[model samples]
Target: MDFDLPESAAAVREGVQAIAREYDQAYWDRCDAEKRWPEEVWRDLVAGGWHSLAIPEEYGGAGQGLLELAVALESLAEGGAGGAASFMYLLTPAFGGLTIARHGTGAQRREFLPRIASGELETCFAITEPDAGSNAIEIATRARLDGDHYVVSGQKIWISGVERADFLVLVARTIPAAEAKPRTNGFTVLLVDVKEAVADGTLSYRPIPKLGTNTVASSMVFLDEVRVPAERVLGAPDEGFAVLWDILNPERILAAASGVGFGELVLRHACDYARDRAPFGRPIGTNQAVAFPLARIKAQLELARLMTHKAAWLWDAGRPCGSEANIAKLTAADAAWQAADRAFQTYGGMAYSLEYPIARMFRDARIAKNIPVAEELVLAHIAQHELGLPRSY
Candidate 1:
């Protein structure tokens, strides 16, 4: 019944907002124009310890949960950086820190968590393949046992932040989907040393030309006979479905937060422009056409944000949240896209101009519907799981 955010989560939002204020829309425009990472803001986040929200205090982190992390990302997006800024937290803290903190073996935790907490190391997730796309079970990446090492070879597409990642949380098959007894069996999650693999010529990547969110590069990563230590297996070998879900649910929740935040950002811009721009006797916002859609989107954004918080809370409480996560992602993506489209309309011809942040935000809001998980797939999940309908695809 309680709807307010916890005091700790509110503190995270305030802290991230303070940092985000230093980097205005103009700063983000420059970074987007140059296709550069927001290093200054990143360093500020590092100094503020925002990066360690999901890690355990025992490992030098704030010992927070996904709710706090989601709030931080939401605040960052609403602040002006858009959904792209969420990558700063998604790559290292959620994918690298939270996963290891929960599923990593004792030795693995000892080696990675402290550095991850300190922001000295970063990680990227590689699961989506060109052929497989949303169907992770069909991924052909293979890792074969070779003495104490697993020799891995595969290609992953649309991997984010690989250029800066020190490690890769890679999903590969020990046994092909065709050969495994259960479809989910035989999957293994490995932590690959990115620099070492690249130096030895076993790994390579090329950035894919993307429309928006240029702040971080999504790349086509190829691993050719990469050798990973056997000790690097993240969870129980051949039982990686659990680990994958652990990674994916939080990812969807954070993506949902990003969507909700982006919606708020664009809606704010649209409202500002609608109130001030007066081509006629009165402001454009005086028209219900201008004001109603924005108002409707505002309602949708708040609902999506509430679901996002619920999903995050369920995750932090170790409750099953697959349905909530998917719903949050679906509703939030729709809200963000609608908000951006409305904002574009509100700006009239000026939305296309780079002088305003609307153009960049318009582009960034779109990919949320497709990436992390597609809106259609999310709907299908709800159809099957929530309603107990027969599975589709």
Candidate 2:
């Protein structure tokens, strides 16, 4: 594989960086400190036409590859738009547009995809439940067909951007485990209208206060007998898992890109500080101790970036990339975590201060190890699917 980015990828990165340069560390710090959403960043991304680069061309998108998506995200981070993986930039395409573009019917795609591509619509994804975080098939959220509509009711924890979303790509169990051909069968995906559901009093959400990445609200949402039109169903009935499955690898690949980019940001900050800050008449970077961890972070981050690109390349080529995606996420998260820790150590007391953005990225990096799929679960997948080991979970 070629090491350099293609012309399209370069254009994507350049466009994204132009927008990201508008917001510096201080803006994100105030947003995180107040637990406020970054509306300014969101607006800039929307205006830049950077939000919908990956949806189908017919749907008002640029028809760019997912590698472009990763590049755009990384560009944002590298330009100092750090916390929340530049969620204001990438979340819509990541969770909302990609799934519908792949699996939605003509009408479903017609209604949502263009709006998403135009940055005129935004949505959240709901899958993880309070009771079933990792074991998705065992989820209690259910949708029952009732004449022309389906009644959906369930509790979803850590559902992001509920208040700001126009809709939710909701996963509900349509067939009970006992009645399914396989235990994983019978779940259905629905595109539920968030405003209508809430106005009718069928949905309510409480924002989750988080340690970092506070630009978007991580929410606990409760759905009580929400009515969704039958036409809102994504893919075939009881085939929701397959629709979700199409997006998981991309999600992992995107998460890997975010983590790897954040690692690069941290390393840059530390290296710059070490190069300039001198004590005892010599730059601190002259000391092996100060320089070594940054070097290690640089090496590991490049390794993660390569893995991520391989996975994204395979995915964009429409090849089976499950194992590669999982491995990329695992390695990138590890690299980001170590990078953040080293950044903290390298910055010393300043790391603890809110004045420095490194602390924010470091805190946010802590969440990467566990999200978009945990490292432990990625290892489980590598073992079971890649190494021919028995399924442990």
- Which candidate number would show the highest lDDT if scored against the true structure? 1
Against the true structure, candidate 1 reaches a TM-score of 0.99
Candidate that would win on TM-score: 1
Model 2, range 1-393, lDDT digits (tens) per residue?
A: 578988888898888888777887788788888877777877777776677877888988888778888888777776776646546544588778777777888988898998997778998889899988877878899999999999998899998889899999888999987798988789899999999999999999998877888878889999999999999998899988778777678888888888887888878888888888786788889989989878988888888888888888887898889999999889988988898898888888889987888878888989888987888999999999989999998
Off by over 4 Å in 1: none
What does candidate 1's lDDT look like per residue over 207-270, in tens digits? 9998989999999999999999999999999999999999999999999999999899999999
Candidates in order, TM-scores: namely: 0.99, 0.97
lDDT measured at residue 273 in model 1 versus the true structure, 0 to 100: 98
lDDT of 2: 0.84
lDDT of 2 at 30: 88
Ten contiguous residues with the weakest lDDT in model 1: 80-89
Deviation in Å, model 1, residue 1 alpha carbon? 2.0
